[model samples]
Each structure stands twice: as structure tokens, then as C-alpha cells.
Target: MLSVSGDVSASTNFTLAQIQALPANTQTVSFGSGTGQQTHVYTGASVWTLLNQVGIATNPAVKNDVLGKYVVATGSDNYRAVFPMGELSPDFGNRGNQVVYAETLNGTSAALTSTDGPLRVTAPGDIKGGRYVSNLAKLEVHTATSTATATGGGVTTQFQLSGAIAHPATYDLAALQALPAVTRTIGANTYTGVSLWDLINASGIQTSATVKNDLLGFYLVATGSDGYRTVISLGELSPDFGNQPDIVAYSMNGAPLPGTGFARLVIPNDGKAGGYVSNLVALEVVSAPR
Candidate 1:
């Protein structure tokens, strides 16, 4: 049994038990004025406990870093909010301190017709009402990966990309044509050229012996020295005129490539761009195992 007490700017208030009765994994936290109040005191259960109760398992390998993730809570009304992962973990020591789902209010349950009632997300205690997500209908946990890539015939763990390279901030036609190729490797995987593979592979997707040959995709958002971004796809990785794509780096250059840093992925392929893709800050990969 769970209990909560707080003032909301709504015509009514809700309680934990009332929330639990609406959906198995659904929980709500309410705040704001008009239909609700602007004050922030959410009643609901901890997100961690709810996840465990719902049997949605987190990967054991990355459990320690789970606090760095985020939860995207959405409502039936299409309203949404993002909560940082750290707020819901053991860092707070209160099992019920994480995001909460509210169903009842003001000692009375909300009727089905009430738009403000039925469900909402109560943010962690430390967060203010501006952070609390009211009228939440769906909660999704999103793990942030620096990069994603295919490996062992499947996608491997995502990783962060960062490095220094000798090149101008932007490339003109002559600069793009004259730039030297860069090479890098991670674990047994090596990449030569300019494909976003390194970014994809860095995205923290683990692969086991049983799973391989998976097609992988990554969103390579390269920010220039001046804050310009260029997005490239896997197909665009092949070299131009030659077998390799112009934008990718390749071993054909006949030199040893740099080793990928700790928890990093090596990008392979070729690119005609002159600017070296150093200082990579973010990577994301989504894939299915073969």
C-alpha cells in the first residue's frame, strides 16, 4: 500500500492507491493550476519499483550507468516530459522518490470524464513543479548512447566519440579533395575512412556469441568547429570513384590507424570532406540482432 498528501491546483486531488487501480504499470504525479495547481507535491510510487514490479528488465551489463539515462513520459493528451535517470535510482535512497503515477486526488478518485485525473507523472522530490509531468499516460526509458554500429554481423555496444585531428573547421572543394584520411579501431573492430560507423558502434549495444550479422543504423550528427551539423548515412559511407566512399577513411592508405579510446567506437568508410571528425560528442544506434 502507498500513501501521498499534497496540494495541487486542480478542482480535485489524487492518491497512490487510486492510481494503481487504473493500470498495472501506470502511475501519475499532478501539479499546475486551473485544472490542476502550480504547486509541486506528487503522490505516486518510485519509478524503479514500478519497473521491477512490471518485469521490464534493464540490461545487467549497463545497470550501473542506468542513472545517466532518461525517462520520456507521455500523456493521452499528447503532452510529454523528460526526466533524468539519476532522479529515480538508489541515489536518492527513497524507493518512492522517483517519478510517480497519480490516479486519485484530494482523498477522492477522479472520474473517467476528468481530463486532469486518471494519470500523471510526479517528478522526484527534488524537482520543482515545472519538472513534474502531469497527465502522463506512457512512460518510456531511453538509454543515451554516444554512437551505434554493426559488429560480429550485428550491432555492438554504443560508445562516445572524441579525438583531435589536424584540419580546418570547414572544407572547400580544394580542401576536401586534399585532406588526408583518418583511421581508428575499437576492440577487434577497425575503421578506416569517414563513415558514421564509429558513432553507431559507440552506442552501447552489446552482442553475444549467439547474436551477430545484425544491420545497424546510426544518426551521425557531426558538429563543426562553428557549430554546424552534417548528417550522414551508412550507404553514403562508400568512397566515390574508388571502391571506398569518399567520406570514409580506409586501410588502403597503408598506415596504422589510431586505437579507439576507452569505450569508443571506430568509424570506418571514406568521405571526401576535408575537416577531420574530431571532438565527436554524441552517438545513438538502434538495431536488431541477426
Candidate 2:
């Protein structure tokens, strides 16, 4: 099985049929012996398409944080090769059909050799196939951090946004509720605050046109006053923009917290509160390196 994880709103484990179900592209790239190299046809989905489906940062605004990210493809034999996120994205830098998770070799009517696939990753541009891994089993992102730890939290009284953002923005209880309101139910309680994306938008960190291709590496790191931390993708928090589930709460059950916790982060549709953190103190939007 070929699966996807990391820095995404939803993780997808793909079967052969499932992989084939996605948009497919056919490319003719050179692949043969040194004495007489020959061309071969590859049919598979684009890395950019897959990255977008699973939620990667593709906006132009987050490039400073998007650059240097990479993807790690691990094969069944445990062999792995790294592909820079920039090299696989249209906006960043992808040449021809340079990187593809090839499912069909020769033609759609021909099956990949037993050793070649169920699913194999091929870089058509390489003179040697050392990085063209076969029997691919997993693909995941790795984040690279270039920023120092943020300061000024000695006695935090509000919420803060950091990471891939252009300028850090802070929000008090009133400021949080002032943006917009969305009420959602979790178990037996109802909670309210602006969606987490609202706070992100206010922070000036955004998905710009050119940055969209290399977005999957960015994340929303939520930390609480009690040291409990939870991570979520920026995609899930974007409404009409990405997927669902971006909420921060100032009121529980239609009212403020009971003499405790200034605010809460709630992810709806989940049965547990593991990712739903309370007493939120900080939200960082750092990029993940490949």
C-alpha cells in the first residue's frame, strides 16, 4: 500500500486502484541501459496534485518558509530518496515530469514488473536511476526551521501567532471573539470563538498565488498555558479556502470559561480532545522540512 502522512488535514493510504483513481498523466522519459538508452512511458499523478489533495502550503506568500522543504519516499525494502519540495512544485521549480509516483510503465496496458511496482517513484531527469525507487510504500514531508524561538511570554494574557506568518499578531479574549463567531458542538458542550484561520489571517501570514505549489510543509502548532501542545494543518482551518475544522473558543456552553482557561482550540468531528487543546497560549505556523 502507498500512503500519505504529515502536515496534512487528512492522511490517505492508497491502494493500487485508489492511486489510479486520481488524475493521471502520461509522460515519455528516457529509461534504459547505458550502451543504448531508450525512452519509456510513465502514467501516474503529479506530485503537485497529490500535495494539494493532502494539504501542503501552495500559496506564494509563505515561500520564505516554504523553501528548503523536502519529501521522503520510503520503499518496501526501506530504501529512501529525498526530493526538494521546490523541485516538485509548479510555482517553486519542477522541470518536465521530473518527479512522479509511476504506477504504469511502458503503457497503460502494461503492468509494472513485479520488482518495479505496484507503485514506484521515478525521476525521469536523472541520468542514473539510483533515486528512482521501486516498490514505494510511503511518502512524507519533513520541515526545516530557520527561525529562533519567539520571546515575550513571561505573563501571557492573550493568544499569539508565529511561524510562516509575515508578522506576528496577538489577540485578547475580546479581540478573538470580535473577528467572527461559529458555534460547534463537542461531546456535550458548545464552544465559540473566531475560527483559528481568522487569527491566522489577522497575523498577515497567507497563502499567496505563487506559494500554493509548495504549501504542504507548513503547519499550525497550538500550545497551551499548561504546556500541552497539539498540531494541525493550515488547510483544515481555512473555510471556503481549504478543508474544515478551524475554531478557537472563548465561551463554552454559550458562556465564558468557568473562572479558568482564557480560550480553547476545538477541532470538530473528532471523538477525542487530544488535538482539541484548552487554555491556548500560542499558535506557531512553521514550515516542515522534507
Candidate 3:
């Protein structure tokens, strides 16, 4: 059995047969003699699918925390390697590159050699077999401390974004305004800034078929400077879905505003101002608890 840990809702153990039961992918790789001619087909499960089974955020739009995330694949011999989650994330532009937990080598009925596997990683596009971990014993998902940095454009960004994404980006007033403009009239105020959806995309979370399929589990939770938080669904950010005209407000009434949270968040869809986050310290994409 293989142990999976870190950033998961619950630790899990899986047998070789169980791993094979998940969705599988196939690839051909050649390593012997370093001539790239001795090729063999590798087939196993998608790492993303495995993460999803353990409830590790898997939405394309939700994005992971800005802190960063990586997966550590270790072998029974103690050899290991780390890969950024984004490389395996479909939304991060590496769409077809799949890092799979391989069970079968060469043919459907042919299992991996005892020296190489009952399981191993079939690293996508990796020419070096160094990434092809054998006798897989554990897979640990790791996350880094989210770092928020303001652009030189006179913006001081402190808040972070996390969820099913790879990178979290911070923006200041000038930086926020630098994004595509979406001006709208809210309660007693005409706000101009980027749409909340655009801001989320700027943080590296994007819409893909996978994201659309998993929208029900996705939400945005904004933390205000006052320590208050409000959650919004991914569908709510779309016009066809909820038609919410939410935005990260930079200028109120079309005039330069001097304030603590220069780039504030406004929820025009909410009847009450309870969802209005003033001085948002953090804007995160989260997956609803399974």
C-alpha cells in the first residue's frame, strides 16, 4: 500500500490494485542505454484524480493559496523528487501534461518489473528516468507559506489567494486599476476597478472544463482588514449564472480615493452590505468541505 499525506482533508492508504482502479493514462518512455530507443508504455492513475479522492482542492477556478504547492513522490528505497502542483494543474496552462502513478508497463496485462514497480511515477515530458520513481511508498502534498508582494506601481499587497490554484498574486491600488476596467454603480458609489473574476484569474486560477465541472465545490472567501470574511460561489461571479457585478473597487465616484484599503471589494449582488469587504487583507479560492 502507498501512504498519501499533507494538505489533504484526511490521510489515505491505497493498494496497487486500488490505485489502478482510478482513471488511468498511458505514455511511452525510453531510458535504457541512454539511447532513447528502448521504449516502454506506462499506464496508471492521474495524480490530480488521486488528490481529488482525498479532498485536496481540485477546482480550476478556485486556485491554490499563493503560498505555493508541490507534490513529493518517494520510493521505497528513499529516493524522492518534488514537482509543483501547477505543472499537474489543468488550469495552469500545462493542460495535457499528466504526472501519473503508473501500474502497468508495456501492456495492459503486464505489470511493472519487480525492480521498477508495482507502482511508480510516469513524469510527463521528462527525458530522465530520475523522475520515474520506482517501488512507490508515499506521496506527500506540500504547501508553502503564501507570500504577498506589492508591485512597484505604488501598490502594497498583503492578502493572498488559495484554493485549486497554483500562485497567489497581491495587488495595490495602481496595480488593481491596471487590470481591465469594469466600472459599475453600487449603493451610493460608482466604483471602477477590475471585476472580481478578473482579479481571481490574475491570481493564476483559470476556467477550464475541469473547473466548470467542479464549480459546485468552488468559492471565494475574502478576508477584510477588520477580520471579517464572506464566501462567494464561482457561478455567482458569472453573468449567466448569478450576474453579480462584484469588483475590486479602486476609485469611488470616478475620483482618486485615499484610504486604508485603496483597493476594496464590493458585492453589488448582495441585498445587505454584509458581503461588502472593506480593506480586503486576503482573497482566497476555497473548495467547500466534502
Q: What's the candidate order when arranged by decreasing TM-score? A: 2, 3, 1
User: In candidate 2, what are the lDDT values of residues 1-290, reduced to their tens digit?
Assistant: 77887655578887777677788887776644445675667777776677667886433553233433556676787666655554455643453332244534433546566776867776655544545667888888665443323233333458677777788877788777678788887778888777777777677764546543233335666666655555554433444223455588788897787643777777674444455656677887765543
TM-score against native, each model: 0.36, 0.51, 0.47
Kindly report which residue pairs in candidate 3 clash with one another: 63-163, 63-164, 63-165, 64-162, 64-163, 64-164, 64-165, 65-162, 66-168, 67-146
Best by TM-score: 2
Q: After superposition, how far is residue 263 of candidate 1 from its true place, in Å?
A: 18
Give the Å error, residue 5, model 1: 29
Model 3 CA deviation exceeding 4 Å by range: 31-37, 57-67, 93-108, 145-290
Superposed model 2: Cα runs more than 4 Å off: 1-138, 141-156, 206-212, 240-242
Residue 197 of candidate 1: its Cα lDDT? 39
Residue 86 error for model 2, in Å?
26
Tell me the number of clashing residue pairs for each predicted model: 70, 23, 10
Task: Flag the better candidate by TM-score, 2 or 3.
Answer: 2
- Candidate models: Cα lDDT each: 0.35, 0.62, 0.61
* Candidate 3 TM-score to native: 0.47
Native-referenced Cα lDDT, model 2: 0.62
